[model samples]
Target chain A: MTGTEPTADETPTTRSIPAVAVVDAQTPGNVGTIARAMKNFGFEELLLVDPPELDPDGEAYGFAGHAREDVLPNAQEISFDELVSSYHTIGCTAVTNEGDHNHVRFPFSTPRDLAQRLPTVDADTAIVFGREGVGLTNDELARIDEICSIPASADYPVLNLGQAATITLYELREMTLSPAGTQLPDLERVRASQPLLERLYDQWDELLVEINHPEEKREKTARMIRRVFGRADPTTREVNTFLGVLRRATERPDQEE
Target chain B: MTGTEPTADETPTTRSIPAVAVVDAQTPGNVGTIARAMKNFGFEELLLVDPPELDPDGEAYGFAGHAREDVLPNAQEISFDELVSSYHTIGCTAVTNEGDHNHVRFPFSTPRDLAQRLPTVDADTAIVFGREGVGLTNDELARIDEICSIPASADYPVLNLGQAATITLYELREMTLSPAGTQLPDLERVRASQPLLERLYDQWDELLVEINHPEEKREKTARMIRRVFGRADPTTREVNTFLGVLRRATERPDQEE
Candidate 1:
């Protein structure tokens, strides 16, 4: 989305990604920051739901920087009912602790999990961010289909409105962009299967016994090895190579040096 | 990191995670919001690098809410060179374009990428954020080891300081908290090797041909299938099962039901 100031020749286009809607936000800084975040994450639609009057030329634009025309100018003012009807509503809440299990906002999806689920959602969706001091009213949250929250330190879970929007949008953008290009290979590489790992472990155990590993420390040593290799999740090929090395190392003295 | 205000009896502990530092941030609101972001991401250390005098009783504490003690009271003031020597400095910059490639901040790592690398970095690390208007100066950036930027729309590259911190710290926290306790098993599950994927593709192509998929759309259809399955990255078991199903589906009427 270009942040160019709108001219008579230009027309707005609707975006396919989830639209961002802030409900009753109090500050221009937050509004501007939200706009900037939407642009940063390649999202264009913004709905100002019952927000205080925002001046495009003032703090809103000042904070929005280049997103002033693309995101801020195009932001629509919509009613709560309109928001509910136009898209599958996702309410955002900070109340995600076990204490809130009975609360309406319980079982909240973290932003990353929500992002992965968003693209598969068949309809237009809106992620509703609540106000600064107090978040969404209980009544407002009741109508939401999904509750998404950023996991944070429970001691002070409150996040600035702008920060919350940025984090959520960042995750969604990360998920969306991931499939298109070089997904993190390190994170996605195939790992050795359980049977292969166990076999490798058995080979290593025999080697340890033949080497006369300190009797008292052998179990601790084996457990450490299991823990370390288990965490690594080596690939099948790697496991095979390691097993080959172990076989040679453990072979009797009759084997050639 | 708990958000509780620190008391005289409670001692602060040094954290292994990167410390957040702000240089010449103009607004108290920005400082408060940054503190809130830090707390939200479980980061404890905050450094105010030559900031204007801030009133803890005013906007900073008011906006920080529960993070007042854990973040605000513990914030330290230090000089530029002091920052450089104290930690492996990561300079924050908005200028990540190719034009700036020759510039000091070129070749910046995205926040997510940086987060992945942070855990292995052996030293105290500080992610230094710049002023609200201009980010870190080129001279200041020169002394830093890594430049980390959030990927965003080129139209409005500027992000509110607080939002930037929130997004960067959120990514780091996500990566840090990940791989502990129930990580996404579906996402982390080892995938089938390339040879298996190719075999499955060959089987699917034959099935598509058998189903009388139109000639003109066959390549496109096959490509779409490849993309879909490629993205899913089915496991060895899943691929074997699907291939078995495809073999049955493509068999002549002589095959058993």
Candidate 2:
């Protein structure tokens, strides 16, 4: 399931490519703040790659304020490679269109521009934000289909991750003419559902080992599975597909070693 | 020494006309916040007209943040009549472009556009924000030379006075290109100066009493006076020349009175 491409039945019109992503994020405070911003803008799918510092109770609560449940606990955490491999139309926040992928910079895209583009893609879209201090490496930006930048002072070109997220989500939400599109619950409901990720993680770890990959490849393989679920944000059918994929991988019979 | 038109000898370049005016703005928090915003965008002048609610200490500190002293005491309190009679170009913050005043930045200027226009006007460019809840009255707007709007969501566009001020100033500051320009005040030294505007206010009030006729007309007279000074952030020479006019008025016996 992780390696498979979309089949014939995949709906191209449901463009769920999100308007935000956090890459190698280091702070839970920023994550929570970004979540609040996402909630405000009505975008729930949050993607994080290689987040090293995560404290749900301490930082996320403080930053999220009134809207925590809007944050997906199943926020897929994967490596840089898997993230690029999964998405068809990912925009990086680091470089602009003028910049080359090796010197990658996300070109400045107004929220209105992204809002218009979001609904057209066949696959999930990703808006990627980089780590707190250093931005996305040029190599990482290479995989992004669009590179957009927020025009800021050259004196201090970078925005605080939360502020950047807030502005993007706010703009997109502003463009949302349909008020009833997605009804978001409060923080408590989201927290109640976080345990689902923990359970899924346990199941995934078991399948990773049974695939009988070399020790060096086990973590890498497990991470790719995380990536697929992370970017796809699978609905019931997709989630079921993942479960079947895991079941088949583990149930395969081989000579006992 | 608070009001005067430009003299023939003065060659002009560069002006900072603020976009929001809080005439006789009642809330101290709002006032301080406006001051803080002015300081944020390098705007030092503020005009007040008939404010019944002002607690200098509590508000100046909170809104101005690190630059409390930047709130000039004279700007802290000025008669509306004085502002009106003094300014050559008093631009109101009107949401509409239908009025007589030509070329008001409508549909809002990008922060960059406003910044580019800053250097073209003379010293007397004023951005007038209205009171806390209800904005400036239509009659008040009708009298101004022009109107300026800071674009925001039409759904509920009223920005908290401070937040609105902050965004305006932030946009201007961001638009500033620092190279070849003199260095701005180091972060530590941007405190609001109170004494200069305070001294100017003393002279202005006395002038109002001098030029001010009929007790019934005194308050209305004051509002107009404030509007003038609000637009013309008079220089020291300009203030002194205007003061001389007022002093002479007081020294002479009025023929009618």
lDDT of each model, Cα atoms only? 0.76, 0.54
lDDT of 1 by residue, A181-212 (tens): 22222223346789999999988898898899
**What TM-score does prediction 1 earn?**
0.62
Candidate 2 Cα deviation (angstroms), residue A235: 48
- Please, what are the lDDT tens digits per residue for candidate 2 over residues A1-257? 53235667864344453646788777786787676666545566777777756565677665564455546464667666666777654553533433212223423354446656665444656677887666676676767766555444433344556555655565465344244332211110111123454456556787767765688987776777767656433333334445566666777545346
Among the numbered candidates, top lDDT falls to 1
Which regions of candidate 1 fall more than 4 Å away from where they truly are?
A1-15, A97-103, A174-257, B1-15, B97-103, B174-257
Q: For model 1 chain B, give the 10-residue run with minimal summed lDDT.
A: B180-189
Classify candidate 2 by CAPRI docking class. Answer: incorrect
Indicate the residue-level lDDT of B229 in model 2: 64
Task: Provide TM-scores for the models.
Answer: 0.62, 0.41
Interface RMSD of every predicted model, in angstroms: 11.6, 19.9
